[model samples]
Target: ALDQEKKQIEKEMESLNLAKFERLILEKQFRVLSYLIEDKKEKVNIVSCDELNNLLEVLEQKKQRRQDIKSHLDSLNKELACSNFDFEKAMLYRDLIDSEKKRLETVNLSIQQLEEKLAEFERN
Candidate 1:
């Protein structure tokens, strides 16, 4: 009985560790999503005071981000189509995808405005 109890305890510890690891992964993923959505992922460049260069770099990042978002959304949709569909998770991904597209729109607008300003400056 003592040996059985020890084995049970070990199993419980392993399950607890797995749960903790999963929670940490979830937290990290959410943090990444938050940063990507908020345009805060590339802050180290802003410290250099090169607004034009930084803006261009940021626009490139945003373009890459839009591609990533679309891929993720596609994967989520594929998952939703599987035999074991997770409705809640699919809805969550849908919402994130919508927000990501909105952010992309804003980024595009910002890039357009910057290009217009540059053109105007060059004209003068």
Candidate 2:
């Protein structure tokens, strides 16, 4: 009976140890994954779902900015064609148009960069 009791206890301890070792392994995997995430930045493959989501969010913001610029351009174009167009306002809008065009370029560049990053991530 005593021998039987010891064997049962030994079995329980082995099970506990196995559980503890598995927990440690999971912890290590999490730490390593975090490190890889930090190292990858916007480069490629190593990006996790969270980072990809963040990139998607940023892309949405850029797209919104592009839309805003386009709408403003349309408004300005209409104003320019109006018979009572104010020269001062036209000058201001022209300047704004130039800036908006530059902003559009930057937004496009950012989109291109993100697309490239996604492609690289996929290829990996």
Candidate 3:
């Protein structure tokens, strides 16, 4: 029964309407970061202040999206609680979702850190 509940939650999360936009934003930001890194490979000098500013904006937006998804997941958890649902099988699915969230959070943090580093570098 627990397994079934978790699967249900998984299905609901998977079907979340907002996930599509969230994923698109993430992918777009990731592509920009890739291009920035690639551009750095061709230049010997430091990156421009404007470039750093642009990247900071992108990172901030990405972080905001990450936070939004997290909040949505939290809301889903509350829904699960109110439903008084329990299932052992769902535990595995729940763990998977938690792990994926953690991974995305880690990436978000990395992006924030990189942005901070770039800001500091540009300041000097």
Candidate 4:
């Protein structure tokens, strides 16, 4: 279910055509941010003042990317959640398929059991 939701969300994002660019930018920012965060966490003596400032700028960009991706993803999720198929009909179809699958499975199991019994009787 979670995977289905994720794919649905991704499909909607793809339809909007922003997901690709967002993904690309977000990936780049994430990689850069990881490096910058490591730099910031290093011993103060290891990083000069200019390097620290540069790290801060990258952090800011990472923050912005995080916000944008979250907002866009949230909006897409909401839109997908609220969008409707005919609930009654969809549910009916779902139930029908479920019932058919269960019936088929039962029939298959019965056939297997009968075949086993027949084989045993034939061997006797």
Per-residue lDDT of 76-118 in model 1, one digit per residue for the tens? Answer: 4564466353676556556655665665576667557656654
Q: What overall lDDT goes with each candidate model?
A: 0.57, 0.57, 0.55, 0.46
- The local distance difference test score of model 2 is 0.57
User: What is the C-alpha lDDT profile of model 2 across 1-124, one tens digit per residue?
Assistant: 6446646755665566465335434433443443344334433422455366666665665576568667756765675576364776567557655655776686678778877876766677
For candidate 4, lDDT tens digit of each residue in 1-124? 6446646755664566555435644444443454345334432422454344444444454345445545544544454456563776445435434443443454345445545544555576
Clashing pairs in 2: none
Give the poorly placed runs of model 2, Cα more than 4 Å off: 1-50
> Model 4: runs farther than 4 Å from truth?
1-85
Better of 1 and 3 by lDDT: 1
lDDT of 3: 0.55
Error of 4 at 118 (Å): 0.7
Provide the lDDT at 69 for model 1.
59
Worst 10 residues of 1 by lDDT: 19-28
Where model 3 places Cα greater than 4 Å from the true spot, the runs are 1-50, 86-89
TM-score for each prediction? 0.48, 0.53, 0.46, 0.32
Kindly give the number of clashing pairs for every candidate: 0, 0, 9, 0
